[model samples]
Target: MAAANSVWISLLVSIIIVILFIQAVPTAHSQNDEDQLIWAKRVVSGNQVITNLQFYFHDVVGGRNPSAIRIAEAPQTKNSTTFFGSLMMIDDALTVGPDPASKPVGRARGMYGSAGQTDFGLIMALSYVFSDGIYDGSSFSMLSINPATETVREMAVVGGTGLFRMARGYAIARTYWLNAATGDAIVGYNVTILTYV
Candidate 1:
């Protein structure tokens, strides 16, 4: 009877341990997800100006023209509040020339410099799917407009979070620098591009 009782007690202890483990796992996962969300929010809020400026350029350039542009993959989020976003510098030189469909002019005058203008800074914010949720933190990168290739390659964070499915949302802002001599003539334009997955 003593031996039987001891075995029963041991079995009970083992069952209790298993139960505790199962309960703890979910809590840990929840905490991790929460922490990620917080980090993302901080990043997004910190760069609000950059994000706003990019959108302003997007509006001015309109979808018809491909001014300075950067494209990035969307971020992944289990819920509505979690997402990723990015900003890119715009290169106007690539887009200023005559449309490829049009005949070449006798001499193409350089509207802007060979290299397009760079943004003061680009900022991005990840948007939540639901209207009520807060924006997720943003991922940042620098953009270089390559006239030869007619492409804007985002340098910083190129292979990082901005390129993966982990990014679910994005926003962009751009600032244009005008020449004082030209009386605030639009000398340089900055563009920010945002994407949401």
Candidate 2:
């Protein structure tokens, strides 16, 4: 009789401990929801202006070598791959020439992969950096732009630095002018940024 009572008590204690453990364990969704709530405490946003984004792209193997693979690959490109860089003058107008006194607000530089890489329209990945004024050192990624189309283009702003730390946003790239023949162009950008600042 005493032995039976002791066994019953041990079983009851095990069951109680199991019940407590089950209650303590949190579901995946509950943990994810809690994290989301925590990150929402801070967020700041503003518009970033960039204008007269200009660059010249050239491929040497295409033209200099008569027996080259191809001078370019595009509407009329000579080189399939090229490394290029540009200074985006910070002026608001949609005109061709930026004011001489206007400062270069950002930088656009990157390499172009082969045309076979269908991931991006332009098949190039570029980085934009804010060098002067209030946003110095804050840089963002530029995803891709299809050179074939001249309509309002778009690029993704993945992340940033400095005042724009932890920033994420998108940019509207408008092709003011594009020379399919020479791969030269003038573009404008209006970017909306979200950050901790």
Candidate 3:
């Protein structure tokens, strides 16, 4: 009977500890959420710092092992001049140089859709996941329109994880090389981010 009483006490203590721990941890609330304006608590703390990064993205759209593949399309996509309503998923390589043989540092994984009816524009929603150097295991989310005809375009950096928690900024992307026949391209990216240091 005494041993059974001790076991119950231990279980009660553990339950109390778990409750306290849960209460001590704050819940996450999005800044854009309406409820956040009423009851949001400060959860992140660090010195605000800006960092600039430069890299290259290699997109292989053709060949046996392609990085970008068309996943869906509208009924009239083949007949449309802009390929509107087409969607593609990509796992493109991020490299240190414009050449595909250059050292790989990370990957860009996401989906892009041809949403423009009159122009060749893509709505990009991707994450730049890093795997090299100080940025290992870090990643940032990007969302913006990529005007394929433009020489340069700016992409929005909305949020991130790991070393770039709560990140926000922009990335300037420029086409470095392109194969009109194969639909393969190398794009250079210059990213500027405001993040916690």
TM-score of each: 0.18, 0.47, 0.76
lDDT of 3 by residue, 1-197 (tens): 99999878876865565455435433323334422221111122235555566678998999999999999999999999889999999999997666676667899999999989999999999999989777889899999899987999998999998877899989888988999989899987877676876
Alpha carbon lDDT at 10, candidate 2: 75
- Top model number, TM-score: 3
Query: Which residue window of length 10 is worst by lDDT in model 1?
Result: 50-59
lDDT of the candidates, in the order given:
0.27, 0.43, 0.79
lDDT of 1 by residue, 64-150 (tens): 554433344234322222112333234332111122222211111111212222332223222211111232122233322323222
The worst-scoring run of ten residues by lDDT in candidate 3 lies at 36-45
Q: Which segments of model 2 are wrong by more than 4 Å? A: 1-102, 114-120, 145-148
Show where candidate 1 strays beyond 4 Å.
1-133, 146-177, 181-197
Please give the distance, in angstroms, between residue 103's alpha carbon in candidate 1 and its true position after superposition.
43
Error of 2 at 62 (Å): 12
lDDT of 1 at 74: 35
- Winner on TM-score between 1 and 2 is 2
